[model samples]
Target: MNLHTWVAARGGIAHREDAREWGYSPSRVRAAIRAGEVQRIRAKWIATSEAPPELRAAAAASGRLTCVSLARRRRWWIPEGASSTVHLQVGGNAHRHSSQAVLHWSDPLVDLGPRSLTTSIEDALAHLARCFRFEEAMMIWESAITRESLDIESLRSVQWRDESSRALARSVRGRSDSGLETVFVVRLRGFGVPIRQQVRLAGHDVDAVIGSHLVIQIDGFAHHSTAADRGRDVAHDAELRMRGYTVLRFTYAQIMHDWDGVERTVSSAVARGLHLPPTERRR
Candidate 1:
């Protein structure tokens, strides 16, 4: 294979040993770097200029992508407030230098050898469980399953290394459409409010329903962006209101950046008896 194909096949980066295994001489690799066809990551790794930033970072760290970095690359929903650190998984015995990146030293379930720039989906989820808080970890886990990046059956059989990891595994329901929805669910769980997720009401599937008469909508950018979609959503909210249900809508920004405001709004609605069933409201 040519340099472009070789680099592309290996996630836009390759090690000197990989090129050597493919019969590329050291001089040829050096020539490619000089000719601007590829850039040297360090003494041993080389990458095409078109390689993604995460891959380049992994190459610089002499590590493979894992945890949140891998999750973001695979388009899984990353929870709000998740650290921006570049997460990498190195060997348990590997000597690592100090850097701004977060390094994990656990053995992988499926080894990607030393030069691979990305982690397997299973390994990513495992690392995510160990790295993040329970709610944030479950959000990512469910989102991965929802996106079909990892299969539910495979998740069931994977061996978890700790109680927290096992608990995260058991909590995977694969239902939340976005990280915002995951936050919505977890935040409401503490209120002792009986919530029905993905419930059909007034010809629309809402994000959640609290108690009996409160319909909550979470507007992620993808699902509710167009003008006509917004109009339709407003109409649905009106219809639900006409049906005697109190409707509350929260955007991705509101839930992520101004959570105190969001929680206060919900709490006030519940305090006003808006979330209760008609019989409870009357009583």
Candidate 2:
């Protein structure tokens, strides 16, 4: 591939050495730079104009993207109302380069070369454990586990540097089908009721089942948007109800924007023994 295509293919930025390794000579790189096909950052990095702003910012700051910034790039589920601050990992002795960026000074979980513009998944999760609250961190961790097909046992084996990280490694079951489900499970853990996720009932997997009968279905922003999808969900709910399941359906807005109301509704259901089996409830 040509220089511009190659650079753009690599997320619109690349190390000069990587370009050379890809068979572009120094003169050719210089020519590309002069022709405005690529721009050099510091002396070692070159970027096309279409490079993501967060990556370009990291290159400019001589740091690697980490924490929520990298999580967002990797499409991990970030909690609603989480900070949008650009998070970067820099050397401990590095001076403040940008007031807008939140700098992480911890040593990386893995060694990254100077040319690397982003932290490894391990390092990003380690940083996230420290940067976000426990529930928020768990959301991203569970999303990463599901998206990456990460082995939970292997994650537990890593020598995580913080108690939060270790706790998360222990707590994460990698069972959440989506970040929304993770949020629901983590937040409801305090209720002391047994909750099973992705339970197969009525030939469909419900989001969660509390006790033996109460079923929880969480709808993401795009979930059930289509009429057909909504119809299928309605039919499934009806089938579940006919089978003696108490179905509690929640939307993204109800779960994220108005969690208090959601919590109240759930707590009310549990308080009235709605989560119990019919025979147990009668007792």
Q: lDDT scores for all predictions?
A: 0.82, 0.89
Where model 1 places Cα greater than 4 Å from the true spot, the runs are 1-11, 15-36, 39-44, 92-95, 221-224, 271-273, 276-280
Q: Model 1 shows how many backbone clashes?
A: 0
Regions of model 2 farther than 4 Å from truth: 92-95
- Please provide, for model 1 over 1-283, each residue's C-alpha lDDT reduced to its tens digit, 9 standing for 90 to 100: 6676788787788888989889888998888889887889877888887888877877777678899999888888887567878898877543366357888877788887776788878888888988888888888888888886566666877887777778877766666767778888887788988887888887789888988998889887565467987788889989998888999988878887899999999999998899986667845
lDDT of 2: 0.89
